[model samples]
Target: MPTSSPQPPPPADGLLSAARRNLREVAHGLTHASHPPTPLFADAPRPWQRLLPYGVVLALAATLIPVTINFLISEYGVPGGVAGALGVAQAAPLLMLAHRPLQAWWIVFPADIIGALVLLGYPVATYTVWPWTPPAIVGYLFLLLALGLRETRRTSIAVWLATGAAGVVLHVISPGRSNGSALLLPVLGAVVLVIAAAVRERGDAQRRLAEQETISEAERAQRTLLEERTRIARELHDVVAHHMSVITVQADSAPYRISGLSEEAVEEFGSIAASARESLAEMRRLLVVLRSDGTEGERAPQPGLDRLQQLVEATVRAGLPAELSLAADLGDVPQTVDLSAYRIVQEALANVVRHAPGARTRVSIASDGEHLTVVVANDRAERLGSPLEPTGTGHGLVGMRERVRLTGGTLDTGPLPDGGFRVAARLPLSPASPSSLEDL
Candidate 1:
């Protein structure tokens, strides 16, 4: 094999090494970033709530450890400065942890463990001064209590057992054997252990109940969405079906009746056909909306006041020559009023086209102080042949009545004594009323 060329030396200033090191650091940061950050605790008055009580226990150890060490030294003549230093050192780690509540448990727990070992691990006879007994079982018992509040059951239990065992064993192993109150210390320490376990178990059950409530809330939201879809379907079936039926009847009769008419009359029928096509197109659009599953995004427009003109033109084209007269210059009418006016005019014209194809229609809109009136009156058809509007479901009239009432308006439709159909509506223009904002 041919000898391989020596690999190029690393960048002169160690650029390659620096780049590789930076890549490793970025990759390490990404890995850490993916983990949910430990949630920060809000700055509450009791930031050290969980650990301060534990600090009190450490303080007792500090006071007791040095005093017990000094007393032991004076009585038994065993001495050292180690007891005083270790007493203060015990609380140092705990106070540091108190500054960051979320990070305290890991650091404080281990410090408590090491502090206990440092004070108690020596032989009894070796350093019998304050190091031997002053801090006592009190410090360790309070540590278990704090652990119960801050940690889970299994972990707290382990720490509790270990600390309690150390307390009882060290009591028995010490050289000063008091034969008088043998069971006293063991019985009190055992009670502390039982209290810690109960507190830990209750915390676990409360957490489970909170999780169940969150799941129930999500299910209710999904059910409400399904019910809303069903309501939309029923509205489309009733509204579109009635409007389309009226347009079809007028369109079919126009061509036959006006055969001998002038060009203008023929053109009127063509316009009516176009209007019917537009109404059907609008109904199809409404059908698409009703069938859709509304997902989160921008909303679509509905047939409202803005579409009033289209409604009036369609009606006029339905073989009824109609004149539109505004009462108070209705221009910037509220959308709600626009929709109501459109439907009123639409239904009135459809009826005129069906009942009196030859009669000219006049639509008058006039505002009278606090109310507006809309009137559509047409002369009766010149002659009657086969029934043009059979199977009158009457739903068209009923729907118009409902829409008027919904808008706080009153409507009347009846045959004129002169043999024509006349429809009139009066709608309130109160400031609180939705249609009162109409510009016209």
Candidate 2:
């Protein structure tokens, strides 16, 4: 293999091009009007809290303006008019510091340079701080603090470098002059800028965390809703699909069961049987889509009110003292109503066990021919034990509401006045035809 030729030395033009691009970027950042005003106490809850920042700024400006004007006029022997103008230029920017820091800096920086140049022409005390007066330094520090809070780190760094460069120029033009301010301003300004930038970074991190938490909550709720719907579909499929299958079988056997049936009667029964079978096939396909996975559905029959006694007995065994009172005559309850009532009671009891362990619980079922009502109430926990399971995903109430809605029913659930909980559901005995499932 041939040895690779040594890479040519980096071109001087490349370095110059990079420097020019950086300068243009810095100029754009300083001059651009795109930066929005940064609000003080943006998350303050009350009006008084929001107005507090303005009060502080007003006080600072009052003190700085008079002091600055006196210093420029008396110490530096400047004329009253010129000293007043420079003082106002330096102090007024503090008022704009909270909202428009960059603009304020633009005004104050030049004013400081001009004031220094004017004072240079006159005799000054050797002990006096030159270039940057005390009040002027304080005002610029405030401006830099706001700039760090509002602007990006890149912009902030550029601003700091510019300030240092200006200080350097002032020192060069007046060599041997007392240059304490030239050294002091840049060092102090750097500290203030660093602290303000750190605070801003922390606040941004917290806001992003809060937003992520909100998004996670929404996603969890959506997932719970889908799960509840899928479960409802599975139970109803077991109930309704069985009935459809029965209808198909009965229709097929009708002609054979009866004696001397006519041709027209036989043809009608055949049509009914065919329609029932087609409907069952379509329903199964719909169920497949509803299921979360391709696994087989529950093979066991869905529970109904007939299983309430066994469920209560199991609850009692599971550390919950419970009693059940069911009406003797429910008057041939519809299968949907029966299943929903059972599920509602089951979920309510489970909630009691999870949230209020060893609580006194009462489960009652009553019917008045038109509707069946289920109520599960528990007093405050008599004793707390390790829960039967870890805290649940808070979907119990959501499932109950969904079941009641499907059966044309109403649910009422809330904490009782005695620091207990109650879940009551009323399911219609004769619900309207389920048009919701017609597509299936």
Best by lDDT: 2
Task: Assess every candidate by TM-score.
Answer: 0.39, 0.83
**What's the alpha carbon RMSD for model 1?**
18.6
Each prediction's whole-model lDDT (CA): 0.53, 0.85
Question: How many clashes in each candidate?
Answer: 12, 0
| Minimal lDDT window, size 10, model 2 | 431-440
Per-residue lDDT tens digits for candidate 1, residues 174-282, read: 4364232224434554576578667647755876777778877777655544444333333444445555657766765777865687778767877887787788777
In candidate 2 the C-alpha lDDT for residue 207 amounts to 89
True-structure lDDT of candidate 1? 0.53
